[model samples]
Target: MTDTLETQPLDRAPATPEDLFAFLDAHGIRTTTVSHPPLFTVEDSKALRGELPGGHCKNLFLKDKKNRLWLVVALEDTAVDLKTLDRRIGSARLSFGRPELLWETLGVRPGAVTPFSVLNDREHLVTVVLERAMTAHELLNYHPLINDRTTAIRSADLLRFLRATGHEPEIVDLGPPSGS
Candidate 1:
């Protein structure tokens, strides 16, 4: 049974940056990309944002106490109080996933993790978390799959891409409650 599944044409192919872009285009989701030096951290990509018009992102690959994995995509400037983040996402405590596991599950290096990596998650093991504030933005930017380039897409298109990949994201307000 496993062998038959592996040979099926419907099975997902190994994901690549080019494949990601093609997938985006095929869905009628337009995006613009720029090539630059590799950027692995939010701070590293700051300067490049000058030429890009969008909400730059800080993507986090996290794991919970029960080993459930999550990929959080939030505005780069959003304050992340990790201590309180699990409550917002319904996890029993969360910590950054190790680099090895990041590559193993998302098929990307630590610095290059993006929501797009979910394409490689054929097992659907990773749950995506999108910040509410980020959803308010018209445009958002993240690495396509590699850290050497950035791709800007409409925020709605992001949700579309995630759904298309069979990973419907959990949108949450990562910040403190409005009244609090």
Candidate 2:
């Protein structure tokens, strides 16, 4: 199964947003799908948002002093303070990871960060985190290994994917942004 996933490449896939959905379905995954324009960051997602049919998500990759890495996914507009997040997560030093690790662990590059990339985490070293508040939403949208597209899946399946990775995520609900 791991080999199947690793060797499978959709590099020449069509430019349509459904590429992610088709990839999931071919693997027997059943989740709702939403399409949107290609995005590089949460802010870049704005223009492609409005018509989106599900919850917006932000995928972050961080590293601690010990060189331990983490992937934190939260609501799109959520304001994340690394200082507070480090304290809450017990990470001695939490800083954004470089693009290389994103590819090493998740088989994805910088702009394509997403929890779904856990599919390629054979070593299972990267930690997963989620802001508690996003659970209130029914579904969430995220990249599917390739940045040229996006995917929408049930909130439960997102959680399931995290668990299936054999890593217990550090979940939190940071009240809100400190200032307006």
> Per-residue lDDT tens digits of candidate 1, residues 57-158?
899998887778889889888887779989889987998988777777788888898998998888888899999999898999989999999999999999
lDDT of each: 0.84, 0.70
* Model 2 lDDT tens row, 11-33: 33222335445555664656754
Model 2: how far residue 140 lies from native, Å:
0.6
In the predicted model 1, the residue pairs found to clash are none
* TM-score, predicted candidate 2 vs. hidden true structure: 0.79
**Deviation from native of the Cα of residue 95 in model 2, angstroms:** 1.0
**Number of colliding residue pairs in model 1:** 0
In model 1, what is the error at residue 100, expressed in angstroms? 0.8
